[model samples]
Target: MLLVLVVLGLAAAAWARTASRGWGLAALGVVVVLAAIVLTVRPRPATRLPETGELEVGGRRVTGLVLPLRRPSGAQALGVAVLAVLFLGAAVVTFVTQRPAPPDAVFGMVLLAVFGVLFAVAALALWAASGRVPYVGLTPTHLLVFQETAQVEVPWSDLAGVAPVVARTGASPLPDAVGSWVAVRVRTGSPAASGVKLRGPASRVVTQVPGPTGTTTAALIGDVHWAVDPVLAWWTLSYYAEHPAERRELSGPAAVERVTAGDLR
Candidate 1:
């Protein structure tokens, strides 16, 4: 996503070289909006929950909550590839057409160069993250989410609240246009809330720990469709947050089946 924005910025810079300054600025503005979308438009989970099963973690049963696989769609991959090629082609064109750098265009050229490097780095990161199998595990001790940026573990005791959030791209009578999500909040000063100090990229897109939501919670899972059963996702997480003792019951396949079945409704 970051790479996409950078590519657009570079393209805009190239356009600015030959076009009006106003046109260049307009292109940059669009790039900004696209960057915002990358942050706001949470992608739908590509896969359903993990298989209904149990696993032993720290001598206790832990249930694996399936996270959507992070692979890019064919269209997405092809689009990025094409964009990369175009960026390269543009670079060559710029080189071949090189004349004395106009003083006015010097800043633009530097900006383009910087953005090009950033775009490459972001593209590489996205590629590498795609290869890892990301997932979240629910256990009596903690809720573990392994993502591109980080592995987050939130203990049930630290949980503050859980609620459902509905976000929409546009208002319509159609249900498919609405996005359902689960928001979670945790007590301040907890390790999971603040996160352990780590180095490399870990899923830091949303707060792994919760925040204030004025009778609600932090916006978590989102861009969900009706088919994904947001209610079930909300119910399961909320139940665990509110009723820790009964959480162990969900460690069995039968229980998972019942919960999933209910979610379909």
Candidate 2:
């Protein structure tokens, strides 16, 4: 109601000055509202390593590498919950107090109430998971990914290779806005790779890596995306795969410093 009043006042004030000015104000207002609706959360990393750089999670560990995770924002959910409650209350009040209410008023009220309940549930869940955001670690022996409740540790010996893949997400209207992924290519017919799919939840894309002319038989298992920087994740993983001697540093602060600096050694 307050936002509506503010916009209405701005439009009215602008119109008194000039019709063109009023229309421009209304257009700007529409664009602001649309941008807010389009973006789900602030574009930031979902996880961050502390200054010390050495940390342990999920009884597993990793060094240097960082995989992407879906950034979660509880504030966004809570804001929606508050609005849902307000709008729902207004709808109920209007339906009950209005004389000669429309025939569909009750049905509309019911639908709105159901939506309100969903918003409330989302708000509660987000708040509950506030401080426990999952993190990924780099270790010499394995590629460790920690989730909210469980973790996945893929031994370096069991993996064939890792590469950075940029797939056409079509997630945005902008042409250049592509999504990044770290594809852990599993060795074909390797018995150890059989359980790779159980590493995490399910991946949205499972296509093979593109080579010179066609795709390879190496399986792309369940992988995460949207890490703070996918290219860095790929570089760290690949570097360690090629240089087995440096794997031990993954559990130390020096590795974190190097990864953060984008240093090539």
Give per-residue CA lDDT, model 1, range 177-251, as digits (tens): 545555555676766667444222112323232235432232255533222355556666666677766667555
Model 1: per-residue Cα lDDT at residue 21 = 57
Among all windows of ten consecutive residues in candidate 1, which has the lowest summed lDDT?
198-207
Measured against the true structure, the TM-scores of the candidates, in listed sequence, are 0.60, 0.59
User: How many backbone clashes are present in model 2?
Assistant: 7
The sequence of per-residue lDDT tens digits that candidate 2 reaches over residues 30-125 is 544344344434555554432323445345332444444553566655565563554354345545544465555555555556655765686676
Clash pairs of candidate 2? 62-137, 62-138, 62-139, 63-138, 63-139, 63-250, 68-227
Model 1: lDDT equals: 0.52
TM-score of 2: 0.59
Number of the top TM-score candidate: 1
